[model samples]
Target: MSEPNRFLALFDQVVDQTIAFAELVDRAGYAAVPVDTPALFLGTRVDKIAIGALVRHLLLAEAHWFEQVRDVSPGGVIPFPSNAAALEGIPDGAPLLETYRRSYAERRSQLEALTEADLTKEIVFAGRRYTVIGFLWTVLGHHSFHLGQIDLLMRQQGIEPPEYMEWPEDQRVLG
Candidate 1:
């Protein structure tokens, strides 16, 4: 495939993964969230950042990076909340889930509209230069990490998390 085609294909893969994760979380049910999962802020531990904050955190992180790509400074993401206390002020569950869905959709639209040249251009972030692809890779990894945390939290609450997305052929549907 040509360069443009290659980038589109890769971008599509990221979209697929994001959608899969969102579906898994939706099916898991937020009402069953763990009251307390291991959480920390900075070096000193505190009674902040609960399981309820995880989804919002992941969604906001996606928005933060997307804003940075628009030439906004990392610190320019005003109202970007980093802790559970701040998130607690926001409505969660269905309200937040809808917001989360919109966030990811907007990010995907932004990426899909990028030209191959744009993807290859360098973006300086935190004194380091990275291609558009490099920045997205970081976002993808960060989101995946948080997804794992959510899964662990669910297990701690004795709620079986949704299984990983797999080939329909690999999974028996009517077993």
Candidate 2:
């Protein structure tokens, strides 16, 4: 496979795996937790936000970065919320995960269509310029970091998280 295609496939796999993991969380009943339940925050107790708000934060961040890459200004992204009222519009449980998945599928079609040249096209955000590929790499890494946080959230709540994904032999892209 070509390098750009491989990167796109990896991105899709990451999204798919996240959706699967979230399904596990939903089935385990954590996703139904009250909006006011504390999120697993920085190894400190004082700065914690609601667990549902953490999910919303991840969704909004993904949408914002993807929109920036598409040269579209993000509108209506609520700032990370500290309380339940701030999370008013976002859904909980399966509905929230479905929204996360659908937003990516809709917004990322343009990204998935990019040629290698397009991947190298520059965009500026947060006062720094970077290629589309750079932004994608950032998104993948950011999702991974938050995935671990979700895992910890599960563990802290006395639920064993879903098993980690094993790369399938046929899908292996790296030697």
Candidate 3:
């Protein structure tokens, strides 16, 4: 495969892993980890936020970053509620997963139109500059970090999160 095709394939892998993991969590039932259930997030500061809030934050952050990279002015602020009371509007389970799917479909379509040269173009955001590919890598890494957090939340409730690290045969690019 060409370099551009190879790079784009990684995005597909990330999306597949995210959707697969979310499906596992959904099948386990949102009741398994109640929206208001406090879960510890090991960030710079230890936060015990509601699991639903964290899930909502992840979905919004992913979509926001994707939109930023696509040069689309976002419509509203990204939600990152500090407490359950602030997250009353956030939906969990299949509805949240469906929202992610829709966002990914839109972002993926934008990505498909970019050439390899476009990936190297620099863009400024929040007073910092980053190449298109660099921003994309950051987005994928953010997904990885949050996926682990979600997995921990699932395990805490005796729910088995989807296996993300496994190299599925279908994704293998055979020579």
Per-residue CA lDDT of candidate 3, range 26-80, in tens?
5445434344434444442234443454466666666666665666322323222
Name every residue pair that clashes in candidate 1: none
Better-scoring candidate (lDDT), 1 or 3 = 3
Error of 2 at 5 (Å): 2.2
TM-score top scorer: 2
Estimate, for each residue in 18-78, the C-alpha lDDT of model 2 and write its tens digit: 6666566644454433334444343221234433444666676777666556653222222
Q: Ranking under lDDT, best-scoring first?
A: 3, 2, 1
Task: For residues 9-113, write the lDDT of model 1, one tens digit per residue.
Answer: 544444344344444444335444455355344222223343445566666666666755655443332233344443455564556666666776787677667
Residue 19, model 1, lDDT: 42
What is the TM-score of each predicted model, taking all chains together? 0.63, 0.69, 0.68
In candidate 1, what residue range of length 10 has the lowest lDDT sum?
166-175
Candidate 3 Cα lDDT to native: 0.60
Candidate 2 ranges beyond 4 A from true positions:
26-51, 72-88, 167-175
lDDT of each: 0.55, 0.60, 0.60
Tell how far residue 47 is off in model 3, in angstroms: 8.5
